[model samples]
Target chain A: MLADQQFLRIPGPSPIPPSVQLAMGKPMIGHRDQQAKSLIKQLSPKLKPIFGTEEDVIILTASGTAALEMAVVNTVAPGDEVLVLVTGAFGDRFVKICQAYGIKVHRLDTPWGEAINPQLVEAYIKQNPSLKGVFATYCETSTGVLNPVKELAAVVQQFSNALFIVDGVSCIGAVPVKMDAWGIDILVTGSQKAFMLPAGLAFVAASKRAWNRMESNSTPRFYLDLLRYRNSMQNDTTPFTPALSLLFGLEQVLRLFETEGMENVFTRHKLMMQMIREAFKAHHIELLTPEDAASPTVTAVKPTDFQVEALRQTLKKEFQLTIAGGQQQLKNQIFRIGHMGYCSPADVLQTISVIEVALVRIGKQLELGKGVEAAQRIYLS
Target chain B: MLADQQFLRIPGPSPIPPSVQLAMGKPMIGHRDQQAKSLIKQLSPKLKPIFGTEEDVIILTASGTAALEMAVVNTVAPGDEVLVLVTGAFGDRFVKICQAYGIKVHRLDTPWGEAINPQLVEAYIKQNPSLKGVFATYCETSTGVLNPVKELAAVVQQFSNALFIVDGVSCIGAVPVKMDAWGIDILVTGSQKAFMLPAGLAFVAASKRAWNRMESNSTPRFYLDLLRYRNSMQNDTTPFTPALSLLFGLEQVLRLFETEGMENVFTRHKLMMQMIREAFKAHHIELLTPEDAASPTVTAVKPTDFQVEALRQTLKKEFQLTIAGGQQQLKNQIFRIGHMGYCSPADVLQTISVIEVALVRIGKQLELGKGVEAAQRIYLS
Candidate 1:
């Protein structure tokens, strides 16, 4: 039998809603035309509430990594010192990008499945008073660790010169992020994550403080230049011919989020996280991230007494549900289940039940339907 | 009545085929899954014939300009001498990208509506023997001027150390490009043009010589790094989460091209160019580029009597057919009609007929059906 009914429960390029997919299939329009202008004008303001920022949110026609690069290149100049708080793979990426641009990086390293301590960041800033910025990942998808971004932001604000930059790729839309209220100088996200769209568009919101640093920073940049995006936003357009199909999908997705209310959207994701965690706990599985620091969008579980790859294959071959393997150091030791974007309680229920069977098939000897029952109880409650 | 039956006759984000559209709407798959690997492996080799290269073709999830930046950043280092042959806006962009990287640029300036003379390029290289690279645009979309890339490549090959890099964004698929045979060291193109897909993917093909140069060039790069892409492609994957929907659409598009044959695809585009030029001549309209140097993909027409913007607006309002207006200096002086990718003889005929009506409606007296008659004659012959 053909495995045609595929379910993508990975960290990103998440399951696109049918309406968004239909919207993407709509015919292309001129990127510089009035129709495109009107669509952009309508879409930009709607994105602000999702970002929880009243500042400028620039849309770039690149991946999430490019947005992260923009956040670094536009804010810090060469010879400038910056602090990179590493909890997982993405935080290391920020350090690499900053180092590539000749910035002096002071890394605050944390274990893969743990959150960064905001107190440690404050202590580092106190000693390294010359630092220009501090980079943090709100959700480290690799280990499913949700960092304490609000606390981190508050700590960064204590240093007058250091700008707080958050890589919110896998968390922004699913979790609550108050960019303005939390005083995040720069916040970045991608469309493929919780935006319920395909991979192509990346967004970055910047406060005035970030813009001020950008004006003084002299990094050689072209494609990821935020100033160009800001200038084009005034005319309700982009600096490049945007991925119009994805933008159309984004418009539909934003409308769906608005209809459901942002608070309810966050609550739904939180519930999915809770249900998945409860289901795994009932199966006697241990999560990689500590319970208090686990991401609302993705859950990483340790593969105890069973081959994670074998279970993943069984799930793919028998159930047509695809999840993610661990990255870097944790490879083959853990597996990740993503419940972001258009994932529903039903999706969580199906995923849990299938994992239960796959675990037993892979010689884990887990009780059948026990995990499903746990998830059902959470859904019911 | 609704303007539901719309046609995009613009330069890019061209009319996506129904099959491609349907393929794009297929359910999402894991970026690192076996299914995705198989799809990517199946798709990459098919792209080689269109690119006319037997070398590495790296795919990036960004705009065409990003691919151009990659071409520059990989092949040459800062303080290296490079010749930027300017045909129009995109050529100027190449110059800016090079200059942004601190490359010493020797600009061979051509006017907005003219092609770069290969003899002039040869003379420049003869004078400047220390040039590390020569940047040229295969097709300038802004002015519809197709550069003499073959002859220019021949001239650049005479130098032992210099690399011939061509920005083939607008002409790679629509026009015949023999990258290996033409001695092109690096070639770049975007998906939105003749690939018959949405805007999200960019492609770059590199030769062995370019790879050698990249190893020694020390430019700070991460996301657009060719070496990273090469490393991942060995495993039939990308270094990042690709725009999977566009790849699915590309698979169908490549299949369609294979069904039609690559030579026949090029021939069809050439025929469309001929018919469009003949129709414009029948309307007593002058083309922006001289007959010998015009691009087969897009036709730029100078509006002698009618307002170009008014004619464009009328076409959109009355027939829902969107074409392109002039960019920068050519604004209001010219209009562009793109016949690349999925455009047929009938599309050309209809576009000409509508242009005739639009011109007449905007107070420029033109013979009805005159342009269409010219195109139809070419089609019938």
Candidate 2:
């Protein structure tokens, strides 16, 4: 039987705070009511600092992926040439969404665990002068690798006509993404990941540059039509019905983050990432991505001569742990632990302790106490 | 000033039942965890009955409109000819989403308060043999008109190749939609409506016939990709991160409906619609739509020569009542009272009383005692 209760492990939709959950429990409001308008109005401005841009941040009643779709559909018209940086699943998704809309996508494919090379991207942009847009992920959730968005944005700025769309789903609220200063025209994020809420709504911030392109774009869009939202945003309302309960939950969490300060949030994420990385190393488990490029949200580790699948099952069955297996071809080859929103240092330490116990139970040759001791060192440090 | 603490008195995000609210408050679980998968698996079955289809239902983390877009993009490709029956705002949206994808849409425009004529739809299909699909709404939430889906489905069935897609967003669970029996290829609904949960997730059920078209159709879709969800649904999960809390809330609501039985649920909605209609007549307010075609979920009324907006505002301020305003050009000309999902005769009576009070407050010269009397007669009847 699967572990039936208390799923505190595993990243995202990661433990929603009690207060946020309480907010969701509030009575549902009419999506078109003036109250709903005020809520959306307040939320839009509140999210500006989160994106590090004064540009409009519209909340779509969809997932992070939908925000990415909104960015793709709104930016590129039919037959528009685009450059996509592919490192993991989400980047590949961006490529696919672009292709789906009949947009020509040129992918700068990188190794699964590696980050996109800024120089390579610049060269590609230079070569493909007709490229209408560039899509990249700030943090590749699939491999826990962070692309150098600042450098990539600089290259994109050189192509004044091309829109730079960044899927900051896993990166926003965890890392600093300066949409305005970085010249990122479209930056998208989801509430579930870094916002520390349940997945439902996606946050998108668009510069006027992107809006200019949208004015002339001929692609058919209704629900995620940024223009309708743009018009509605002028009056502090949305075109279609919004997710009010989720908006309330988002407000509570964003306020909590504001009180905590974004810099402190980023620093805390870094500390958590370091704690997990150091623990894996001491336990002789290899980190998949290089240290410099590792995502602060999740850490993927390769086991030392053990059946990762069996170990994962044993961890779930015995210790009630719920870590993630590698996606697609990497399945059973790597296990990932997410130390994202609402996860504290004690969470990191305890999760490591459970992994060490599971490892020893699975007869993983040596290093019985190594992982916990390593994690304890990070906790104290 | 925006009305603060005003309850959303509209049909949905329908009051977020305390049970569903408490369910939504449950801590967020890992998207990949067995706990989440269990929730999804449980939800997948529950959604089928609601969709009136035995076919697989793909759950997207999006609003009702987002699901509508998913259905359009998945079923119809660019340049595909589609017949859209526009009776209300939602039908117009269907046309817009279709046109966005470069699908040529022929609108069978009906008056806003009127339902689409089934015969007209059939004639349009016959005239345009090249038309690949017919898009219509089961319940036009805007005008409170329920279109002739069964009749339209009967007509569309004559053209085996033309897919019949129904936006069941506001009608599902409140009314009967027999997808298989009615030949509806694609039917979409949202959690916010009859499901009595927050607005975030939209559930779509695709017939095998729709799947055949989706298999060959090449309109760009990555986020709302039905195929990805179709393939993933085999494993009882979604391809992207879902709104897990909403899923929990949906599970609780579905269970409630099951315990109550579908027939009883439909009966409740019918009774509520009756109660409201009687009240409107007693108030001497003309209904915008015909009683025969009125939605069981909502009632649209042409308020007596009075400031309809002011009355709605007063209702919110005084009675803590919330109702929907007319959309598009109809705004301020008509007001809609929703009586769907978790609303009973008492809720209908309370809404009627508030409307009467607000009418008097705004000096709408009408007999004050008649409205509640009519509602009482209907409730007793």
Global local distance difference test of model 2? 0.81
Each prediction's DockQ against the real complex: 0.01, 0.01
What residue runs in model 2 are displaced by over 4 Å at the alpha carbon?
A1-4, B1-381
> After aligning candidate 2 to the native by TM-score, how far in Å is the CA of A106 from where it should be?
0.6
Per-residue alpha-carbon lDDT of model 1 for B200-284, expressed as tens digits? 9999999889988888889989998999999899999999999999999988888888777778778878878888998889878
lDDT of each: 0.85, 0.81
RMSD per candidate (Å) reads 25.6, 26.6
In Å, residue A301's CA in model 1 sits off its true spot by: 0.3
- lDDT, candidate 2, at A136: 91
Could you tell me the lDDT of residue B187 within candidate 2? 94
lDDT of 2 by residue, B191-273 (tens): 88887878898889988999998899888889998999988877877899888888888888887788678887888788778
TM-score of 1: 0.52
TM-scores for every predicted model: 0.52, 0.51
